[model samples]
Target: MTQAAAYSAARRKLHWGWITPPVLFAAIIAGATIGETRIPVATVLQVLGNNLLGTDYAVGRIDAGIVWDYRVSRAVVAACCGAGLALSGVVLQALLRNALADPYLLGISAGASTGAVAVTVAGVGAGVISLSVGAFAGATLSFLLVAALARAAGGGMGVRGAGVIVLAGIAGSQLFNALTAFVIAKSANAEQARGIMFWLMGNLSGVRWDDVWLAVPAAALGLGACLWHVRSLDAFTFGAGSAASLGVPVRRVQIVLIGLAALVTAAMVSMVGSIGFVGLVVPHAMRFVVGVRHARLVPASALAGAVFLIVSDILSRVLVPGQVLPIGVITALVGAPAFALILVRGRAR
Candidate 1:
């Protein structure tokens, strides 16, 4: 492709990647409201319109108030969580210079899960608010631990040194996982253990709209901060030394960018369960379409991530008979093959 043509392609991919997600998210939410009944798309919109503005339109009617209520909230939760994870992926990959690194690789999700479980099993009111808050606290604490540990192991290398981060993240995540398991196993309540297990697997069902509003500002703050660092991220592609030579404050930018990314990620994980792989896959796929420039890549990844989990969550509804699956499982089932394909293709190139 010509230089102009390549840039045009990148911009087009970014536009399509961004647009396609919201449209797909809307479709999934609409289709899933019917559950196994599979209502038409127009009907879904009509019901949505009715709920929001009372336009007296009906393509279909679900008799269960609880079902639709749970579904709408779940859909919103999944979309926001997916977007957060994708942006975290972009930020972490840029900051660490490791395509293999993910938001959870640093143990943020594990820490959040541990905190949520502690609240759940400690006879604290298992309300959504309590669990979310506890989980957020855990995630932030985990980020600090990782930063401290990574800094101690720095060996005078720049923050973007891939080898140190990969080792540090693996160790940190394993530590938190062990703690989470202990909490679950030691709890005397079977139901609570099962509930904690399910929560760790990730589910967006049964979320309240009020919880949605509480998380909105955090999400915006995280995403906006990442966008502001897009220029630094692009400079990062050339490696820490090169970016420094170009006058980029490499370490300072890494701390700021990754810190913001982790904060948003922790908030999302607190609200939703520890959904995985969205971060690892979505950014990689978007990169294929829109080079490695963070300006285009970050927004495109966010949109793609939103669509991906929404569709995955909807599939979890129908993938089995007379039951629903954790939305996380569906993403792994679907994203694994797609992620593999991307990796294989990249190697072939």
Candidate 2:
């Protein structure tokens, strides 16, 4: 690369680095500001200042509680879920060499959903296992199942069986989804069923500080894993064989990255339920903006996903005056159309 081009790239990166933090912060504050009860942006900021900066802002106790404990926590969790899922999508797509590869498409979400349902309805853990644990276990199991099926179908390391894996993933997703539904049908009462169903669609209504702790670490771990393997991911762009020829540790890379994808996806799905398309949409969108380099694409996708989900959460709260829609519904409403456009555009090319 020419010095001039390198200098320009550095400048661009610095500019975005300066801009993205404030944009993301503003979106989080916006999420806190607009809700069932409209709060001023000023009040939201004051609440944040009091809680985060220990400033005495004289904010009303009720308003402060609402902003700090409820809205802020929810928005932050949404951001974490968004970032984590998006990173997973980026990793899966790069490693698998498939544009359609994502946690949902790979059956991770379905497996998590099944695990969560099993715990909630079937009482599998019988008060010993948390929903997140169950979900993670299910996600790991499902991934193993899908991997085995793909391998059985003649798909192995590299891009040789990329299409086969996707098909296996679809089959795995259907099977797990059916299991979830069966559990709900057999074990849940009316109220339990309704709550489970809503949660299945994705709910952030009960998110709090505890969830924030889980979400932040989960997202951070995913980002760490992705950033750690950025070069290997770049090598993976051509094909697994190409990556191997370039001295990438093909099997180790696949195991570590894909395993982290499943782990992170399961964690987020456990907390937020099956919010779809984030892993599928955000990375592709970022690629258009940041180009295909994983160094840029990974972080860019994480930021965009965070803001996208925060905005979606806000819309869920205010879209109906008396009723709050599930966050998953809002995501699907936006994502499905966006995905179709991606498909149409891809086809046109």
Candidate 3:
């Protein structure tokens, strides 16, 4: 490459990297501003400054509570969920070489739903286990089941095994989903059942500072892990054998990255319920914008995903008068059409 061309490329990367954080910040502020009652942008900024920088802007207590205590935390958690899930999708798609690969398709979300219901409705730990812990355990179980099934079907982490892995994931998801239904039906009362159903469909209504503590760290860790293995992820874009030939420890990378994906997916689902299509849609959409390179793709997807979910959450709050829809509903309503467009565009290419 010519020196000028190299400089131009570096400039482009620098531009994107600089632009993404501001875009994400704007989206979060927008999320904080638009809610059941509209708060002014100035107030939102003041609330942030007061909370983060100890600057008092003479904001009203109610407005401060709404911004810092409620909307800010919700937006932060949504961003974390979006980043984590999108990173999971990126890893799965690159490693499996399957465009449809995502946490939902791999049974992670289903297992989380089952686990959450088990704790909430069935009293799995008799009030000892939190919903997030239960969900994580269930997610881990589902991944193990899918892995075992794939192995039994003569499939391993290779290009040839992608189909088997997907199939096993489908089976595992169905099994856990059925288990979830059974638990709800047998153990839950009418009110409990209603609450579980709402949560399963993705409810961010209860998100608070506590969730932010869990979610932000999980997302940061997932992003760090992905960045650490960027080269291996790029290599796996070709195939497992190709990655191996390139001195990427194929088995170890597969286990570590895939495990990280599962853990991140579970953590998000546990916190936010089973919001879908962020994973399936964001990575592919980002690939179109950022190119196939993981170096660009990973952070790009995370930023896009965070913005996407914040917007989706904003829509969920405002799309209907006096009612907040489940966030999963909003995501699917948007994601399904976007996904179809992606498919049509891919076919055209």
lDDT of 1 by residue, 1-349 (tens): 5999779857765776678656855655653565666655565666667787778864434532433566666677677778888888888887777887787787778778777777767544556558667877777777778767878886234555567777777888888888888877887478877776776788776566876785667656767887777778888887788889989998899878776776777677767778888888999999998788777787788777877877887788888968889878988887789889999999998
lDDT of 3 at 322: 97
TM-score, structure 1 vs. true: 0.85
- RMSD to the true structure for each prediction, in A, is 3.9, 2.0, 2.2
Point out where model 3 deviates above 4 Å.
1-17, 156-160
Question: What residue pairs clash in candidate 2, if any at all?
Answer: none
Expressed as tens digits, the lDDT of each residue in 33-56 for candidate 3 is: 998999999999999999899996
lDDT of 1 at 307: 75
Candidate that would win on lDDT: 2
The candidate, 1 or 2, that scores higher on lDDT is: 2
Comparing 1 and 3 on TM-score, the stronger one: 3
The list of candidate 2 runs beyond 4 A from truth reads 1-16, 156-160
lDDT of each: 0.75, 0.91, 0.90
